[model samples]
Target: MYSQLWCRTGLLGLLWLISAGFMSAQTPARTELTVTAMHPAADSPLRLGANFSLRIHYDSPAAFRLRIQGERQGTTIPGITHASPRYGPGAGEAIAWLAFDHLAQLDRILLVAEDAATGHVLTSLALPLTLTWSADAPPGAPAPVWVQELNQHAQLAITREMQAPADGGDDFWVNLFLQAVFLTVPGYIILQIALPWWTRDRWRKAAWAPLIVTVPMFLFVVFASTAGGSNLAPIWLLLVCPPACFYLVFLALFFWLKQKRA
Candidate 1:
């Protein structure tokens, strides 16, 4: 009798396992997106027309859309929004921004991520927040240059969101090309100083080489003396390159014209 009961129990357990496996195999996988952190402490007050960045990590099916919205004591704030025209991510790292035009006792901020193709919201993350006007600052304080630029950029993002084409007016390739030019143009210009050496006969005096090289060396000295000293971006970083690498292209045609005239 005891053996019979034990066999029945084993048979019932095996059947249940088979049914559970069948159900799980038929179910689809779920999507996941998780926010790890945000900037500025709760006590830190945000300024009007300022921008803030959020650090995010997500596992999205495809490239996702991000937007920012705000609330005060659970009440939705109007005329304020955020967008990502270039920085939107398809997978892995993500980004968001905040922009506002007026002061309010903001109790929280909401972040919404969506499927760019279908407009389906992937996830929404909300955090308690506070915004205020500076007590020490005078009324109607003028924004700093950086702040003004950031706000203008945010406004541009908004306009693009409304007016941009289905292709999203993405400029990733263009930006990549420009950045490559900035980094490599200097190297190419320095190569030009060696042209006379390569073209002249062995016995001929390439008199132009020494003088032309001296100017770039002097410019390098000036740049090295002041490299990484400023908080803002500089025209030429302190390096072993001529300052003309950037504007040298503008003078290319004139050099050709002079050669033609000669």
Candidate 2:
């Protein structure tokens, strides 16, 4: 009986050791990755036609692969080379170079890391970027001929006509003529027909009131024809049409009431 008890105890001890080993094998290791630094920092603007280098420092428990992606104005920016996988328990870094060759309204970059073995994403970071023309660049200076040629194949092309010098001589005279006609013709018709009919008894005296109002209207028409024509033409009409319509309605109502009383 004593020999049997000793045998049973040894067998139980062996099973417990095996069970502990299996549990240890099944539990996943807790791996951590932390970003320590980024060169150029965040939200930095770069000059157009300039080359820049970027670096990212990180601490991780195991080896990982990094991917760099860039976008501008909702289009992908090309010419980014991704770095190879780096192994580290303490510190590691990745580097990349970029060239800004095209114009962009808004730019952004993304850094992503994945576990080398499992292909699981370990970390990600996004940075805002901007590309702007150099402030010291001379005005009206043409871009390099190569840059102009490249622009033709670019997703956001910049045409030579867009960069051409502004010629406002013909446009200015045409706008002025249209404005004068709009102002004078309308007032003349109203004074000759509408005013005489509406105020037949005191037509001579009341004519000056409409003419006085015409001065400001003429000024507004001039502004709309000149300044508004470039970009604000539709918006100018939206603003001006409502008030002009309301004024006409009021005048018609006033004439109706006067006729009713008479």
Candidate 3:
């Protein structure tokens, strides 16, 4: 009877292992992908070109193959060479590298991915691509300089026009700051006022307000420095400053009250 019981236990363990393997095999696979042009968004209508990267997300481990089908013109492209999977075992993402330069026309690209084992088409997406030149970076040669020094300066200007700002600075930061201050401050003040106990303790609580604002202000300055006056999103942080300033005043008053209480 003991031998029979031992045999039954071993059989049950093997059956459990087999069931786990079957579940692993049948689990549904899911993935998400974001394909975006790597090129600057504001390149001029004239000198515009196309560059893109495909980010793929998925679950389960499996090999994938990809293809890019598009029209040919005055464009240069480096083909897909390898697959890079990100995230973890159950969920991950893959990025495919692609490059296109000096294209003067509109084009449509269909990106397709397939399962390597069963030859099943796992996913396919179509991307519409277009090119434009820098609004400030004019087409053709720049006008002649008045002096040799002007010519030297012109060369630096020309090179800068070719590059795109990686940091979000141009105008986004400015407007964002404006909006944040105009909208967020009043709301915060009203909320604070509604709390009678908090309002009564404002003097004690206020000192921390400036401390909180100080860090975000430092971050905004750092963000602006890197953006180089190109993108505008950094401006949104300005909206936080007004309320922060108010809180600073409140903090000073709170400190004064604390001294009196002492």
Q: lDDT per residue, candidate 1, 70-154, as tens digits?
A: 7887888773555564334444555565656666566777877766765656677787767553434234434344444544665
Candidate 3 per-residue lDDT, tens place, 1-262, comes to 9999999999999999999999988986653345532223322244333233344445545555455544435243443233322222345444443433443333554566666544455667766665432334345333222223333443554455444343447656766765656765454455444433344455536444454665666567667757654234344545565666566556556655876798
Per-model TM-score on C-alpha atoms: 0.42, 0.32, 0.28
Q: Candidate 2's C-alpha lDDT?
A: 0.54
Give candidate 2 regions above 4 Å deviation: 1-49, 73-75, 104-106, 117-120, 131-262
lDDT by candidate, in order shown: 0.56, 0.54, 0.49
On a 0 to 100 scale, what is the lDDT of residue 104 in model 1? 55
Model 2 worst lDDT window (10 residues): 149-158
| lDDT (Cα, 0-100) at 117 in candidate 3 | 49
Which 10-residue window of candidate 1 scores lowest in summed lDDT? 231-240
List all candidate RMSDs to the true structure: 19.7, 22.2, 18.2
Q: Please tell me which predicted candidate would have the highest lDDT against the true structure.
A: 1
Clash count, candidate 1: 1
Q: How accurate locally is residue 67 in candidate 2, as Cα lDDT from 0 to 100?
A: 63
lDDT string, candidate 2, 1-262, tens digits: 9999999999999999999999999875544434444433344454565434455566776667666667776676674343344444457444544554555434776666777766667777766766443444333333344333322333122233233323556766876765754554544545445654566555435543454555565577678768765333333343343444445446666766888998
